[model samples]
Target: MTRPRIVIGNWKMNPLTPAAATTLATAVAREAGRVVRVGVAPPALFIPVVAEVLRETRVGIYAQDVSAEEKGAFTGQIAATMLTSYVNGTLVGHSEARRYLGDDDERVAKKLIQVLRAGLEAVLCIGEREDEFDAGATEDVLAAQLGAPLHALSESDRDGRMTERFVIAYEPVWAIGTGRPATGEHATAATKTIRRVLEEDGGIDGDAIPILYGGSVTASGAIEFAKAEGIDGALVGGASLKAEEFAGIVRAFA
Candidate 1:
């Protein structure tokens, strides 16, 4: 069966102290049973510590990113296996990684495979740039991004085993941390398209894949977006930094 909706907080680069982690954990524990599933992706330095805090709570801890390689001399890279050992989960193909760190489709595909091998769920992100959106290439871009990696999955990888342990986040690159979000209608349309692509290309059922919206998501915006046609949940940014605000977004899904 398909998993329930998920609300994920991407605590990107903020909260530099243990005190901040404690506050967020307390808030998540307070609202534990309210939502279907809630997760927080803290900086790598805090993954293990946060994992411990949320262990008794319903909230899951996720790594911001993971390397496709199992192990290497590659300095400064955290492998998926290491993430599974440290964090409760991992996010792959975030836009920032694609834009700044140069993670391409092939890299993302490899990371997804590694995440699966490591026995940790992976969150795959896909979105279009501002120029692509203006050029009406939103659907095309999403299809290409999602299709490439999925199409690369081997027959052994499709044995119904590896396919079920992942989620997809549709984070419009134009809207990320920019204070502007894609309209509810636009978000819905994009998610629907993503679902269709999964079904058509990956042989994944539309109902089985959890498609999330990410990009300037807030507590106030959660209800409207959650009410959207195909949005399974959200990958929140700035709003997620605050415990109260992030908890509010989780409650919106409830």
Candidate 2:
């Protein structure tokens, strides 16, 4: 099966105010019909407002992150179920989540389980650090991140009920927000690694998974990555803030 091409804009606490977020969300939602799968992850505070607006639009709403715990005394932690009604999915293991928030692969694994259990999609992020990439530890790191975590999910696959709802975004840590040059080639390699691990190690249908390339993705980058073999889409960062820019990227798939 040919996986659907997607573009996910992760609006990580930007535009300064709720009103500004509504404006951007509206802009994106207006043009979201251009792509088969397009989503935006706004700050949690604006989720309700944007969700209400985008509910009728073709665009999908995604949470930037979610708590691994189903429920607890963990103050300030948002559970997976909390976002189900609002968003089509949630993003986990983002570089920022792992860096500033200290979300390791184990934590990401738990978060994915929770997202899946709640019947929501998980846009799981996995990547290699600058040094790790230089040392050719990319595949190893991806295997550890994608392999051991979903081992238990293979049982669901055997039941023939688990459609490919999950997505993988491979972001090289060094390239994100640094304006580093990376797109087609880098994403091709990363997607191959991700697919191999999912099919060979995880015993899941790798070909059915939609793997995207993130880290400094621009409109032009989206055009390139979309054409590259094995690259299904893009997980845009700063470029996603602008409606015209993100729309151009969304149209790249078409």
Candidate 3:
């Protein structure tokens, strides 16, 4: 049987202190054995510390973002190798990074390569803007954003590098951190599209690929998504900062 895959939370930019981190870590650890997989992505600064706490516990630690470049004069950038050396893995091409940090598809594609080269899994995020959704271009936008990068990979990159080697996260831009979530139907449809694209262009075996839903995934909201076909897990935002909330969300699979 295929086991459920659920990522508990992504504590983006909150919980700046050690005390706060410890509290959340303790909560996830308390209920770690309930799910197939549980992970937390804290701010880059605390990745090492959080990773230490999650070690030997049920939760895995991750960095929220990483640079496409392995090393160089890109001031203020954290390279994939550095993140892999410190944390278990890192998130790439998140909506915030695409919106604020000017990460285009080309850059994200490079980052995906970097993450894999460094021996860490890449949570490659793809999503549509609210305007695109309003214009009924959600599918088009998602295809371009999610499929283009991997499709652009060279033959070697596709066969040896990315084929079934990364996690795809579908996060609707409007839902992220806005306290609103894409309806279960919407998320399910989008994820299905993502899987089809991967199979068609990237040669990623559908059964081996894991597609995670992001954007405002809550304990109550997660149940419906957990039951959706093709939804392997979630890339949670706000709720991951609190241990209890994240644990509850994980329990949805149980």
Distance from true position, residue 134, model 3, in Å? Answer: 1.0
Candidate 1 — which pairs collide? none
lDDT by residue (tens digit), candidate 3, 1-254:
36358574788888979778877777778876654687888787777777777777867788888888889999998888787666767788999899998999989988888887787877889999888888999888888887767776667666644543578889899886665668878988997788778778677765567788887888888898888877888888887777777777788865
Global lDDT of each model?
0.84, 0.85, 0.79
Question: What are the models' TM-scores?
Answer: 0.94, 0.95, 0.92
Between 2 and 3, whose lDDT is larger? Answer: 2
For model 2, how does the per-residue alpha-carbon lDDT over 90-183 read when each residue is reduced to its tens digit? 9989989999999987788788888888888889999988889789898899999887567756476434434456899988897876656676
lDDT of 1 by residue, 1-254 (tens): 55578998898887888778777767766765554688889888877778787777778888989987889898899998777676767899999999999999999999888887788888999999999998999999999999988898876766676556779999989987676668889998998899899889988776788888897888898889878888888898888878788878888877
Rank ordering of all candidates by lDDT, starting from the highest: 2, 1, 3
Q: Which structure among the candidates has the greatest lDDT? A: 2
RMSD of each: 1.6, 1.5, 1.9
- In candidate 2, where is summed lDDT lowest over 10 consecutive residues? 154-163
What's the lDDT of the predicted structure labeled candidate 1? 0.84
lDDT comparing candidate 2 with the true structure: 0.85
